[model samples]
Target: MAAATHAAAGRVSGASTSELGAAPRPAPPAIQRVRRRRRPSGEAPPLPRHLATSGKLWLALSGVVLAVWAVVFVTDSIAYVDVADTRILQAVAEVRSDPLTQVAEVAGGLATSGAIHVIWLVNLVVLVLVRRWRHLFVWLVTGLVVVNLTAVAAAMLQRPRPFEVEIIGRWSGFSMPSLPVTVLATFLVSTLYALVPAGRPREIGKWVVCALLAATAASRLYLAQDHPTDVVTSVVLGVAVPLAAFRLLTPNEVYPVRYRRGRPAHLDVTGARGAAIVRALQDQLGVVATKVAPFALSGSGGSTPLRITVRAHPSAAAEESCVFGKLYAATHVHSDRWYKLGRTLLYGRLEDEKPYHSVRRLVQYEDYVLRVLWDAGLPVPHPMGIVEITPEREYLLVAEFVQDAVEIGDAEIDDAIIDQGLSVVRRLWEIGMAHRDIKPANLLVRDGTLFLIDPAFAEVRPSPWRQAVDLANMMLVLALRTDAARVYARARKQFSDEEIAEAFAATRGLTMPSQLRRMIRAQGRDLHGEFLALLPYQLPPVPIQRWTLRRVGLSLITVAGLALAVAVGVDLVGSPL
Candidate 1:
């Protein structure tokens, strides 16, 4: 019995040991599962790889291009090529000698008249309405800046006109870079920049436009308005300035996205927080803002002088910050107080705090117009930020201001001013843009320089009706401010009576006094005035000719068929009889 009990105890103990060994051990302290990280799908694209990797290469290439152009320019300046001169003189001699040439010249002259300018101006108005203000502003500002710069340069250079040159019409001033050539070249470049983007179409369009511009420049040389070197230099500067400006000002990213179904898309700002945006802009533009005593202006919103000044920094450059701010404020604000404040501050008050509604609307329109101009790489204020002052009351736009500037009206409109103004208007018309509000107030004269401003009411598409209105408005403004007859005479020298009439018609609403209309009518009755009237009325004859020929051909064919039918009927009736 004792042996059996001991065996049973051993068996039970062995079974208990086996059961302990079979039980699962607690899992080795689990290692946390590692997860792969990923970036958000909507993250902004990083800086372009080419720009990042080959920055020095790009700089080197730019330098090379400039160097090549400079070498070519210097070579041309030292040695005069008379190819254009000889060809032109020959053509002019032919015109004088041959009756056909004279007839052709008259026809061409009639064809040109003021029709082209009117058409171009009308087109510009349409573009402006379509929100292409940037393009218009850029073209106008560029032309103005170029003309002023060229005038100053011409004055400085004071190069004499070609000796033994045939006296054709009237010629004056020192001609190195021909004003017409420069104007034409610059105008073409600005227009191309405005119309074409960097793409296949742009590439093709640029080539065609450039060819046309070259032909135009050559024609100026043929007309003896400029030397070859002058034309070449003008072309070089024309191409260079806008290209550099475009590179500097135009952002790589698409902006002012087309409104979807007429609804404005929210601006895609890199920094949404206001304080951060301000700081970032300040850092980027080298602006120093010092608080000045708050002062109330006569208009609406109270004005506080921020005393915002710009200084050139090691990293950042000083540009027109105040002007940029003003533009921004004008564009972003919906409140009457801010709009009134901006306009009042810029133009100042005429009556005791009364808002100039026309001026106010003009300012707002200019805000939109300036955007198109800035984008097109024309000379204007560099925009920084739009400041909304209180959610409902006021807003301040920050821009770079033109320092040490004077108004064009501060002094008499000299021949130089008239020439510069005409050149500017011509270029704007060429690009299908019009500075509808062309007045002395809008013309900023800084250091004998003319800068066109207040393009809010401007248009950017082809419309003779609108252009005529713009012209009439400008004429009226000039008449009211300065010597009406002198202004009219100067205008008549460049624009025909028809163009003036069309402009008057387009802006007929601008006539504050019926007396102005009567004055225009009386002037239009004169022989010279009648010639002017004929200018804008001469629309392209090609379309009308084509339509007329088509109709005549169709009528002749119908008459011939009717005759044949009658003969056949007569023959059949005789046979039956």
Candidate 2:
């Protein structure tokens, strides 16, 4: 009845019946976007509130504590420090029984230089087993700084151990903040951060370590090994300095102490963040995500690939609970910049080698391309917009998951699939866009249709060379599935012999993505050479090494920056403090 009424109205109004019968589109749901500063290339994301404030607090506390110790004792500006030291020392000396001293002596042995050697040996083994070079370096550097600073300060003050007190326990170079206890405290803090994962385990470890350190301090004081002032000062430096260093450099969120089997680039999708992802999808995107897990992580290095299961949504495509998402964080942004910068230095601005300034921008590119490609009648997942996870710090780019589809490499690639694959590149050319990263992993087959994913590297109106390389990569991927002859035969249908020849000419070393390059090398396949043989006549190979002023400038800056980092590292290692 409504269709009949619409037709009558269309005739009366002189409008097309189809147009009058068409359903009105639903309004898009509102979404909130975090507009924090787009972190510049090579810049780390801003630290979490607790991490930043904690580091500053420790630094300030240590400085103030050191300053007070210096004035009270080092300069003898105040008389209370000595009197307190003497009374504490004399009282400790009163419990000088042989058995008690022996016990005290055994406890104090933990602070000896020998104990440091043992701790380092164990820590080195653990760090190496886990391949935590960053943590190991920070741990060693913090120890060096603490140890050397102690020596320099003690020497400058020349403060004696105690005022006429009989020394029962083993003694060290200086009295101020017994060196053994200080070393022990610093090592404990380093162990907690570098080895233990955060949560209840780390929180409990903190208490255990604190108790141990307190025991050590009491044992030293009981043994009459040093003045009370020295012990107090040592505790402040040992705990504060390393805590600040680790928190600032190796943030738990960025470089977590995970004992997992995957690369650190993959963020943990479990726990609070996982639950939050579920909740965010339900509230913001109207996606009732029942399950969210890391998906096909081997191919994805820049962002964490997530397979989000949708319980319900307005879109029928999402009814099967097949939603794909990529979690982008600060680390991915920095990685994209470095990858592009390296390409720039090596190849001199090969079409669209510019890095994104922020993770949001990096992800928005993929979201934008998905929309553009889908609208252009290309085979790509429907883009479900970006879901803000940690405001600007993290976001998830959600889209259709292409459920039950397998990689073209793993799937049976028949002539239909091969034709669809070549047609994709042809469509790309017609539209003047390029999927700069066309490889096997990015190519998926679902019911004989070829789909492209990971549009983070896609560019519109790319150079002819860039477009040509896209053709070459697609052919290589298709050819790998079947023989070169079949793939090339189908490719010629959409592209000319000259265009096919040009594709091979532009394709060579460094033209392909890292994963594709590795797979080709590992399989001992010369798909490149095979594809070229199929070309009618090979043109001269495209020259990729185009050196420009910008390339030269970036190359020089990279070299200079590396040299400066090396120099600073050497100075830090060689310095006494």
Candidate 3:
């Protein structure tokens, strides 16, 4: 597990006196009393071991390759003065009239000024439009440096073209490192660097790009346009330039995650920005002259909410004052635009996708629901307040921290704990609400008490089917975490057989959260099989429903968006470059 951290007061160290202005107002007694004297250390947890190892290895390998290439290029340049390099060029010149010359000429065409410039221009435009500033910088700088280096090396070496030996292709300029090969190779490799996802895609892309580069280099050499050494130099430049640039410009993470219009791109909730968020909370609380300390916890990786623990200045009463805050920001996901569009077209009439809903609405809804649950005497995290970090970009919801709590997956669950967990669901049902997301992570156990947290997906007065889903998910999650027979036997204490039947029935269309899916997969537990083994009833397979207006509309919209994406892709492909 990789962890990055920021201390509340660390950023103030080098600030001017004016910048270290007065802190926010003191919080209320209830809020202030929970402040803790001890703070989490500022040290960041080492990045995931694999990521750190791979990054160091990648940089080391790139440096070695670049050095070797540089040595080879310099050696070849010096050797050319004695026609030692020309001997190799002269041998390649003998094959100029072969049919392979045409193939080589066509391969060389991919590196023409028009093709190179067009591809570069289109890629640049896409980068700018998508606001990929770091990638944009890297792409632009790598291209400029590679091109200028190629030109300078060519001019300095003044390696003559192979025309002296009856080279077949029409070509000009001195070529020690073939300019066309250099340009095309860099362009292809750089594009792959920018777009390829990690894991298998990256591995496959690397091989494919290498093959293309090898073919291009071989063709340029066989066609007698550039010397064999020139092509080799180009291949080396192609690999080294982009690798070096990305190392310098990109984040240290093996796979850096990007989000849009959220907390500042560089600021995680645990850093100086977190301190600012505390100030914002103070403003909301109308408290003046209070210090806030925030400790960020590891969030669900990628686009989920940001979670942090904040402690305000202690009050005279000295109550343990720690508040848990969850933040929602517009994350930049590759599928977000299409997902949003599809959501709009399909379920525009029915807005149930709370996770992907607007930040303001999501925060407000969760905060309200938490308050409702807390006020109703349910075992839930107490709602503190809500803060708007940015109008639509980011928002935070503060709640009472469940002291000494651990996720159920980390807890020693027994029959009593299972019953306590069921009580929470029963209480929610009694209060006419349903917590749509009930899983191990959401259930906290402390001192034999169970508390439910993060009811952002809960619904007031939900349909019977929705309530059944809540029960089913809760029971399924509980069963997976603890003993299935024990959970089933315990569940019978509070829930009727009919209700259990309804719970299983409602699971037919239940869309399991990603976290639960991962847990199920990791544990190698078959949920449906377990359910049947426990109950041993034939669950009638529900008929697949026909497309409703929402489904149809969303389908059409998705198809249209994909079509538009394809058309844009075609235009990009077909456009002159």
Candidate 4:
């Protein structure tokens, strides 16, 4: 984490301001803070960044790689650098022997073009099959950049391989940055990050790869095929560049590279992300959160759900309070866009499901809506302002976590509960807005009061048909806990026969939230059918499959894209370097 943290307000070197020449007139607030805590000692990450410690370390490594490369590149022009490189090569040549030559031959053969190509194809094809677009993109991009940079650097430097030395190992091309070694390193990184799981597996993978790389570099040096500088720079650029790129682009915390498929990309709520969340709430929202853990993840899809326990807000308060937080990252933003795209294809011009541009925009809209609802005195949770975790990449949406409440589906419903649930939609109708998603999971029951949560799908001034779907979904959820006839009888108190009929008419399969639909399937209940029977007269079910030119175009584009991605995965093979 690269955030500024104020230390305990103690003078350094046991000196007071009076003793240290008036403390140099107190540095400007920002500068003073920076001076007090120059190191990223206790700060949480992604803070006005430098992001995570790993990110900073990688950046520093890349800088060192470039600096060393500069020195090696100038070895031919500079006296001392040339002397050092020549001496090292001479010393390596002194140890040449038949046994070592054979060993070099074997080590050189280990990282072959065929092996690189095979590993490359395997990662590409597997990532495609598992729909790991984020990993695949980073893998491909990192490979392309490293390989191209290797070629460019070699050509520009044009340093012939270890001048005036006998070459015992097979080699080609100018060898300032060792093209074979570069490609080997690139593929090793790609394999480890894309195929291996994170944590201990990857940590162990690093040491294993280090041994392999060291052996390969040693073989090249022993064979006198590359300058020591050549192999050194190669390993640095090859390993460090891609390592940094993968860490920054596809952080394991957000996008872990695993074999299991179809699980939602929920961020792990421990380690750096957890500590960052605690600090973010304190720095941004001024709440001292003691613990933050994932809460009811199975019910959430758009963002990682969290239950935050905070300390007292006022001195009078003794017990801690738990607030709910939705941690939205780039993954959730992609999910939102895909969800909206599917909605657009299924129902054209629904006038509600529009894709946001970035994670910030997504969190901003939710926070804004939450604030609006709370201001309007709706039953939704009161939102604490968004806490930025990684600039625009991640954010936390804090709000009231209803204590001792169960999903309306699990709760025992009463007449008042049903009426309150129904009236929530009615109130939205009166306010010219729509809850959009009226599933049981989104509705909660505490005592007799019904609370609405997860308005990520809610819309302002939605179409009457969309609002009708909301009402129908709500009524179905209510009927799931009680009888449909009773729910209908109570619904008539607020909704007229024609309006209720319109809502049921607009409602059908796929119109209801998937959670509600799945619940219905699990319960083996025909709640929708029962409600339709109780209506005054059956209206023809509104057509849900809206076939428009936009839908047709998007469908064609999507199919074409999928086919293209798979085709590329299958056939996008090339020489290792």
Per-model TM-score, in order, reads 0.32, 0.78, 0.54, 0.81
Please give the ranking of all candidate structures by TM-score, highest first, separated by commas. 4, 2, 3, 1
TM-score of 1: 0.32
Q: Give per-residue CA lDDT, model 4, range 193-267, as digits (tens).
A: 877899899899989888889888888888887888777777777777777777777777778776653455577
Which tens-of-lDDT digit does each residue in 333-384 have in candidate 2?
7667877898788778876777778777877888998888877767787788
Best by lDDT: 2
Clashes (backbone N, CA, C under 3 Å), per candidate, total: 52, 1, 11, 2
In the order shown, the candidates' Cα RMSDs to the true structure are 35.9, 10.0, 16.6, 14.9
Considering summed lDDT, which 10 consecutive residues are worst modelled in model 1? 22-31
lDDT for position 437 in model 3: 76
Candidate of highest TM-score? 4
Q: Which segments of model 4 are wrong by more than 4 Å?
A: 1-48, 51-99, 129-131, 155-166, 195-199, 256-265, 312-318, 342-349, 547-572
Runs in model 3 lying further than 4 Å from the true structure:
1-30, 33-267, 270-272, 286-321, 332-351, 354-357, 508-510, 536-546
Q: Which is the winner by TM-score between candidate 1 and candidate 4?
A: 4
Higher-lDDT candidate of 1 and 2: 2
CA lDDT for candidate 2: 0.76
